[model samples]
Target: MNASAAARHPYLSPDAPRVLAHRGLVTPDAAALGVAENSFAAVAEAHAAGVAYVESDCHLTADGAVVLFHDDDLRRVADDPRAIADVRVHELEEIMSERGGLITLAQALDAFPDVRFNLDVKAAAAAESVGRLVAPHAERVLVTSFSDARRREALAAARSAGAVRRPATSPGIDTAKRLVAARALRRTTRVRALLADLDALQLPERRGPIRVVTRGLVRDAHAAGVEVHVWTVNAEDDMERLLDLGVDGLVTDRADVALAVVNRRGTTAV
Candidate 1:
């Protein structure tokens, strides 16, 4: 599809689950793959691969600089273990990646102007900042957080600023279950109401005794106008099963492998 056509389709519209390059599609063997999770180089690599949407984590530094990174603790990506919120952006910048630079969210967006983004905000304060940074390309962006409060706050900020489109909703499953349970207290109220408000529902691959991506869950979600996107699915068999269950999207570290599987299935059918 063309860029505009692609932009109009929500990620889980059942037409085709667009491949989102998780952490920008780098493998462990690449020179820069494991250097940092959401670096500019990673995003550039995904764009070069022609993936329309890339996912990244957003965290703010002490001095209020928004950056593209996955962890609150620097240990995973930096030499130090300081909390990301405790350090200034300048201080963090001085601690270079093995490749020798830190990537700001602005830089990543600027580098790939046409590519869409899935911004997973890691902090409440970072939400408005992220909304502001991505507002110019709001149609091509979807802001999400494990925190419903943060998602609501970000959407409110974006709307107040006169952003043309409100950020899509992605409410956590835990919150949804609570809402569901509360509503069950009332007679004849449908749990689907809570599900419908969300653009997508993100739950653990398996929650408690029930599998989150079961055929039942997918049917219920689709019936309620919500889409199901499972996370961090790494195994090949698990990927196939999720596809069979009709999940709207699969988030994986191995986007290349996932895309290959999807393509192979398509060719065989043809």
Candidate 2:
């Protein structure tokens, strides 16, 4: 793909470098702030802090409602032994009521109408339902999963649910590995082939010290009109370094600090 064809999907913000709240900004010391990961309060906090994209994961409840949560069970917030899929949405909501309010997929979209969401389908069973829910709101969502099959299934479900425009998507683990191999071989054609319907390459800066987000990877991904977003980046220094390295976005638990780092230089580009 040529440079012009490498233009990103319109679904992504035009802002040169994006900052995304990973699981809605629940810090390691969240107890002090009384917010929990994937909680309504956490998302609200990110929104109040002026983050444009909030990254979250989805799982199914016993009643089959799709919810914005990261873990498979209630141990983190409620300390309950029940799995998320084993309990109904309302029950989980009640369990988390005092810690950080819980909200359904529909409720999250409705509550934060102005925000763009980067959703990860964490469960295979929730894939289709998640797709259907995000279909009408396709323009503002980017759906993904570590499981590539689940990722594609979710996208297909969204398309089947009357979405004229498919939601933006990031390549899952296997697809990303292919891109890595192509990058290693300096094969732009192969890289382009992998980005067919994808909008971005969202990845970690390093996978167990293997160092995934090299300058070449960023350049190649961008060359194919796909953006590169590094994940779970925290600390002001790392944020600045990744931005300096030309990553198109940062998925962080500290959007507050990341935003300040980017805007400090007044229109820093990645």
Candidate 3:
């Protein structure tokens, strides 16, 4: 349930169609990869290599500064173990990786002005900050989150605070489980809410014991005007299987390989 565990088990289902480069195409097996994950350098690498969308995680610092990061704790990327929200942005600014220094959300937007971003807001309150940070480039960004409440909050903030349009709602795979948690919360309600807000559903390939990305899910999502995009797929066999199912998008660490597969298939490129 921690970030490390989540990172190890990316649930990319078979229903999605497009390829979203995870951490800008830095493979886990590589000894010396590109820039650190979620950094501006990584985003730039993805864009320069013709990736359509690059994904990044966002969290707000203690001082209300929004920045890019994946884990709640800084241990993975920094020497400290403090929660990202607990630290002031200035204090966290000292954190750096081998590729380059840490980058602000605004800096990323400025650097990749034309590239489309898949912004994953890590906290509910951070929604407003994310909205403000991305307001100027709303047309080129797609905001997503594991929390529906946070996504809605972000949408509301964007509409009220800026002229930026609400980015399409793409719920994380984990939200699907909330439907089964309580009787008061209808499963249909969750589906309908997702249908209303999202143009696509960003799901892992698997959901608990269930394979939610079956052909039926794809057909159903598409019927409701929602595209399906799976994430963090690393195997060629799995990739081929998903492609056979007519997914809308794919999120992979190997963007170049996925692009090659799609190209070799001779199917129309997304």
Please write out the lDDT profile of model 1 over residues 94-149, one tens digit for every residue: 77555436778888778777777787888877988887877666666777888878
Off by over 4 Å in 2: 1-7, 27-30, 268-270
Per-candidate TM-scores read 0.85, 0.94, 0.82
Q: Write the per-residue lDDT of candidate 3 for residues 12-81, one digit (tens) a residue.
A: 2222245687766554443265356776666666676677777788888888888788888778776687
Error of 1 at 99 (Å): 4.4
The Cα local distance difference test for each model comes to 0.69, 0.85, 0.68
Locate the minimum summed-lDDT window of 10 residues in model 1: 1-10
Cα lDDT, model 3, residue 156: 72
**What is candidate 1's TM-score against the reference?**
0.85
Error at 227, model 3, angstroms: 0.3
Ranking by TM-score: 2, 1, 3
- Alpha-carbon runs more than 4 Å astray in model 3: 1-17, 27-34, 97-99, 172-175, 178-194, 267-270
- Give Cα distance to truth, residue 36, candidate 2, Å: 0.7
Report the candidate with higher TM-score, 2 versus 3: 2
- lDDT for position 170 in model 2: 96
